[model samples]
Target: MKKLYSNTLMQLIIALCTFSFVACQEYSIDSQPEGPLNIQIDAQDSYTALATSPSNVVFNISSNTPWTIESDAQWCVPTPSMSASSSLVSEIVVTMENNTGKQSRTAKLTIKAEGISNTKVVTITQASKEDLVVIPYDELVATEGEDITFTIASNKPWEIIPSTAFISNIDKKSGTGNEDAFEETITIKVPANAGARREGTITVKTEFMTYTFTITQNGVVIEQEEDPESTTISVGGTSTGGTVKIRANKEWKVEVPKEYQSWLKAEALSDTELKITTTVNNQLSTRVGHIILKTKEVVDGFEGITFDINQSPAFWFNGSSENRVIDEATGDVKIMAVAGNNVIANYAIKKGHLTFELADINLNGESCLHFNLWPNAGNANIKLWLRSNSDCDFRCAGGFGWGQKMFSLTTEELNAIRTIEFFVEDDPDNIGKLRVRLSINGEEIGNLVNQTNIYETDPSNNPGQVINLQFEGGLNYTEGDYYTVKSITYEPAE
Candidate 1:
């Protein structure tokens, strides 16, 4: 019984000790925690305001420890009760004084916690309202001869003065004595820009500041004339021709058409004067041709000149120094004229074979002598163009017209005074068709057939219809280039 009592008491004691050990272990586990103190702020890092307006900052904080809010900026003030109690939520308020200065400013607020060594910052920005600014900003652009307006905004009275004489028409030069308000519309005008691009500035003077507004104006361009002046001349029938004068402001050149090249030429006496000479028309009636003169440089009122020439019968052309003669035996023609004055031929057509020789063949860029036979009405035409130092060709003007023998007359042949001949005869196979045969220095070329019309019985090739014989020097008209017509003859073809 003693052993049983002792064993039971010992078991009770062991149970009490196990209970105490378990309680001690539970107490030790409850004494320590895993989570740390958490702090949070609900507020933006920055704030903005106008210079004349005051601003406020508010912060909502959730913290597990005591915290205090303060401001380092002199312009920033915080409430006296700015601390957050431990384990509680609090709202902090800070005030920013009105920014009346002339520039932008910034302020900062700091939030500090008892347990946390770290801090949070909030920034406040303010703008100044004491500036003078113009609408549409600091620059203004306008075209030549344009008008513009501007408005000034300032807190004090201001004056606007233009920096350039080109700017004019100021409606108002000074402000209306109002403060902190935009001024009335100030109008200004720009004159015609006959010069280059221009830029200037207008100074806006205020009590405390100055504003500059730039003005940029476009430039103007002078226009060129399109049509040139013109004149006319009439030639007589005698073998001797007359002279006509051309006037200009500068060095000028003449372009003669091919049809009149048989008897007409031009001479540039001075920079301003051009003398034209014609060969007395040996044919029975009147003929016509053209001359175009152009200046090398642009002149204010002078661009170009056109001449209308009318030549009379051979006997009527007497009294002029230029002369030509036809040999009755072999039907050859000889012509003479001043060097550059009259180098082309002008004649009325007769029923005969025609022969001519090239005294010289000198050409520059795009320069040539033109030859064509057609009624002045400008139809059923044929063309033969001779380019100096280059090639020659023959082609009918209208469609169905034939072209042949490109470069048939070489420079050597032309410079050697080669004779070019043409004959019109009735086509035996085709009735009403005239066959025109061409040759250079006696060498036969193309034999073309003309089916359009026959020569009229009237003294003129076509009565009431003017025929043009042109010999030009330039690509368009005539430049300072010429080809000499050494001699020309016509013989009645049997």
Candidate 2:
């Protein structure tokens, strides 16, 4: 019976030990802590006003657990007395007593939260009484020879100092402070600037701080002679030049258009005169160019002066008596052709003559005749000739046989308004022989036609020779062919 009792007690002991171990294991696995402690603040540093006028800085706090706030300085007090724990977010207002001492003062605020090993700290700083002053403007612009006004607000005494002699006539240079910020009007007069623009500064000095106001004044104005003689000048066709005058207080420059720069040129003779020059006007049409004169400085009233230059044409004839020969008896000026829809000749009908009686001009040297002709559909036959007089026969004339040998034009050239030019000059190589060159639309074509002894020297072959430019068409070809002469001109040798 004794052995049975002892074995029963040992079995009971082992079962109790096993049950206690299992219960301990279950409790350790199910009851585990989560996450870490966190705290955040909106500001790490804050600023306050001077001691006489105290300012409040509000701090926003966020914490996962409950938190408390405390300040290290006696002069800085945090409101809502965070002696107890507050969860989530809390806004605490901190009132700071301004530092009356010479140096600025700072205080540290400590925020503590439960279960967090580290704490958050914010530093608050307060400005001293001597560091406070409010000036209205930092920089100002004053007109030439004018006065400028501005106000300065401060609670302390201040005195003004000008950097240069240009700044003068100050209304109030020094003033005493008051309990509240008092505004004082400051008026400064700037003398007129005769040279370049000037800049200076006005320094405001107090017991401890210094402030500055910059002043800028404009320079003198540019003046020019408003009522001059004239702005238009004329030049002759043989490259003769002219000049115009311009008087200004400042230096001036001329700007010419790019297209006319090749032929036109301008030079400044002095502070008042400008000379205009040009190359020879070879074409039969008048040419005009414009130029601008500008001063370096700002003008009082004028922006720029514009000048016009007119160049005369070398020789111009458009079915008018200006350069043509009119019949004395009938007073009739021969008409060659018209422009656009005015048809000069139609091959389907009878033959037509496009003739021009040029004035008795000496063509012994170099001469050129230019005209625009339009042949419809490229189906036409035309002939051009130049004689000294009407009595001269076709065989004795010096001209081109259009649509024939050495002067054949392409279909594209025939369909458009073609610019035909005839050049007659004494051959350089052969003195007596005349060199006749032809071109279409500024492009030279056909070999240079050389005619020897065809001028006044040979009277039998060429009679009544006076250099008359004429054209006769409609000798041969298709029925629907037609042509028109838009314009014609003669440029005699210079």
Candidate 3:
């Protein structure tokens, strides 16, 4: 019985040992030397890019199981095109096509490890690319001695070459850059052109393309002028007129007309030059005068030189403390008036046409131009007043008071430089009544009969005789009030 019991114990120990060896083999198989399936890559990837250039990014991955890289974006492509990775440490390259789009782009890339929970995502971003641009001028057609500029832009280094020396003065020649493009400016200066049209070209070269800029310049122009040989000479002062130099080979003599002898004088400076001097005309009318210059020794095919001279009309002033004549700083003629001042004229405007040009008629206060008329015989004296209102239309005194007629002229029309014409006629039917016609700037308004009847005569006697002309600045005028009369002329009406 003891031998049988010992044998049973040995059997139990053998069974326990066999079970332990099986358990060890299974543990060894489960704990094999393969690491977790994971991909090691940057969290975000970015690339600065230029137009027409490719961009790339690479990711390193280590995994026990197979791994693959994928992106749904069309512009993003994965390298190693076959399939997943076969090696433990493999590279997944992502390539972006040459950027043709004008804006930046973004994409997401996913890395998947098969049979493992290791998934990695990479956010990819790229900057927008700028195209090669030339600003302002591409082709220049300019005149001689003109300056032309060309602006160049590119992602890479650039160079500019001029075709000829005709274009010079280059401000800048080359530029250097990387992802972002830089601008370079070059200026072309053209020389003075003598005769014909000139042409040239500038070649701008960059990494991607080449630009050819062209230039053409016009020739010079020559012209000749014809006239009365000399410009009309205007004399301002009373004592001395300006001097004129003539290019002549011989001696010359100047002859002054008879009527102008009192004011005009000429002296020979040298054989070919003459200096003309004059005194103040003091007359009311501008002088239409000429001086003849003849070569003492006659030359072939040469008549003498004749110069036309114009002496400005003498300044008119009533000499009253209230009103005076003022020569403007700009050399314009003006009349200044205060209250109760009168500028009277010697010659009257009778039954004829009277024309006057006004530079400006701005009135700070109420005033009018006055005309006094006297008939031939047995007629009453006539008084006519001319005035303007805020609307720039003409107003005059009729039979009664201040506001009689408004000429219907807008303010703009009245302010502009204008000509005023007035005509007076003798009345045959009514002995005392006179007819008046008025026009402004060549447009005639209607006629007025018996306007004021200021001057009246016996039917048989001659009428429409003007006694005198005068200006009265009424009670409203101040110290600074002024007006300008450009010109005045009178003639018999047709």
The best candidate by TM-score is 3
Give the Cα lDDT of each candidate: 0.58, 0.53, 0.57
Could you give candidate 2's per-residue lDDT for residues 1-494 as a string of tens digits? 99999999999999977865674364332111234666666765656556556768886765557777788889898886563453335678888775766455778888877778787778877754674454534453433477777777666678889898888678888887554556778888777665544678888888767888677775532223454446666787556466665665468877787878977998777877777888755433456787777766665544566777777644334343333333534333333322221212111111111222322222111111223232232222223432221211111123222222234333433434246555556666766655555554566553343445333364444322222223333322232233323323444442
Q: In model 2, where is the ten-residue run with the lowest total lDDT?
A: 345-354
**Candidate 2: lDDT of 289?**
81
- Write the residue-wise lDDT of candidate 3 on 359-379 in tens digits: 665544454445445444444
C-alpha lDDT of candidate 3 relative to the true structure: 0.57
- RMSD of each predicted structure: 20.1, 18.1, 19.6
Error of 3 at 437 (Å): 0.9
lDDT for position 306 in model 2: 70
The better-scoring model by TM-score among 1 and 2 is: 2
Global lDDT for candidate 1?
0.58
Candidate 3 stretches with Cα past 4 Å from truth are 1-289, 293-316, 320-332, 340-343, 369-414, 426-434, 443-446, 450-474
In model 1, what lDDT does residue 342 have? 29
TM-score of each: 0.29, 0.31, 0.32
State the number of backbone clashes in model 3.
Answer: 2
Off by over 4 Å in 2: 1-230, 281-286, 296-303, 318-383, 386-417, 423-434, 441-494
Highest-scoring model, lDDT: 1
